[model samples]
Target: MIQKDSAMKLPVLFLGHGSPMNAVRDTPYSRNWRRLGQALRQRYGGEIRAVLAVSAHWCTDGTAVTAMPKPRTIHDFGGFPQELFDVRYPAPGSPELAAEIRSLLGGHAVAADFGWGLDHGTWGVLCHVFPEADIPVVQLSLNVNLDAPAHFALARRLAPLREQGVLIVGSGDIVHNLRLMDRRAPDEAGSAYEWAESARSLVNGWLENGDTQALTDEAAYPPALHLAAPTPEHWWPLLYAAGAAGADEPLQIFNDDIVGKSLSMTSVVFGHDALFEAV
Candidate 1:
């Protein structure tokens, strides 16, 4: 076995992917993501081994990872512009890494799932993060049957990959509730509900303070649990990113804003900021 080196450790990211349109549009959110990609190139001297993404859109019966090379770009969402659907990330996949992930999650139930490829949630963030699609990418599915704590536990198994130069990303909205959203005025930060702001604030605090248990406990936060999420898919990815973080690692929040009445644009970063600081 080749020993992992400390210099190769990559950072973990949890992006609040609001709209699929953001993939095609050159918005502030997309620009920020591009900056991170640029920073990665500068830091690792233009070589990021691979990316492992856990997206909200690819929920499965059990945890799984995409293991196919040249995996398909899935247009999972509908009613988007033709250009959005036409766009392709074209990032390669690593079966080796996927198998490694399966081995790591042997404590849990995880398999190599060849059926599902990269979805809107994964590609939308990566399009901006790695526009050239030069590096390999893999998508991990969220287990639909698991609760928040279980999701976090499964994600913790992936923490070792960071040391092997895999960028672990959890893509989902921190505060996502389309049912209560003001559809007419989507992406409105000023009109964000007070309760939504409070909800994200609590989560932000939990991430910053490294309070993983409190963050996962649904009963502790009834309002945010019931209202901010409504459904747990979008909210669950945060736990994945948080679980990958070291116990006392400091967190940095970026693109911090609420959009579309209920969706939050808040993104978080954990570890390996050498290039980020220079940028």
Candidate 2:
């Protein structure tokens, strides 16, 4: 007797979207996200049902799923121009997707207030990727208190959604030390760039080895990461993505560079082409 294989899962991603400015600019990181979206669309096409963004911008004590029919635009950042504030991504919310996520996680999911909208972390990258705002998107708030094990366990709960045509995106900077950034200086000409390069190399080695233990241990990290991430809120999203991958599969780098001194725009994909089969 022969058994049937389940539908192939789509690729999961954690994007190091650098700045709020990238939402409006034509920088390399911005361009890369855009191109990546195009590639993803081509790979999945109509079979791609919806998206759930686990963004750094939304932090809560527990798992919350945004179930609004139409999510509004939220300018979550401050000090940026009114033009930036005015920008909107009118992607519809996926209530079905939300319910599916709840079902997948069983008791771990919680209903979010309806009308929850996209924040900078969601829109900043989506503005480039799904520019037209075509796909229905739902935001999943991070459980900020969860340690490495808990967070990775939560990601495993989301595994079933991958086979259901949901594109899971974890959006945050890999090196997000806001205090160390000098936005006024050019990216290529800075001491922080040198530090960022060193940090990138270190991360690359860990990613190549699929070393989840090392990736999760900040204490053993290089000095650049210590300087880059004073706290792990923005960086932990990468672990969620990594956790969703096969234990031994190598990470694929989509974007890897530093900008604004302290921000490292290093996006990674978790699976191969076969895994990305038409939704």
The CA lDDT at 269 in model 2 is 81
Candidate 2 lDDT, 1-279, residue by residue in tens:
011134857788888877687899777777778778888888778656788888888888777889888999898878878778888999888778877777777777576658568888988899888998989998888887787678888888887677777888999877887776785774542356677667777876787788888887755777777766778778778777877776676557856677667778788888863322121
C-alpha lDDT values of all predictions: 0.84, 0.77
Listed per model in order, the count of residue pairs whose N, CA or C atoms clash below 3 Å is 2, 0
Query: What's the TM-score of each model vs. the native?
Result: 0.94, 0.89
Error of 2 at 205 (Å): 1.7
Give per-residue CA lDDT, model 1, range 9-56, as digits (tens): 777899999999989998878888888778777877533688989898
Question: Which portions of model 2 miss their true places by more than 4 Å?
Answer: 1-6, 186-195, 218-223, 273-279
- After the best TM-score superposition of candidate 2, give how far the Cα of residue 262 lies from its true spot, in angstroms: 1.4
Cα-lDDT of candidate 1:
0.84
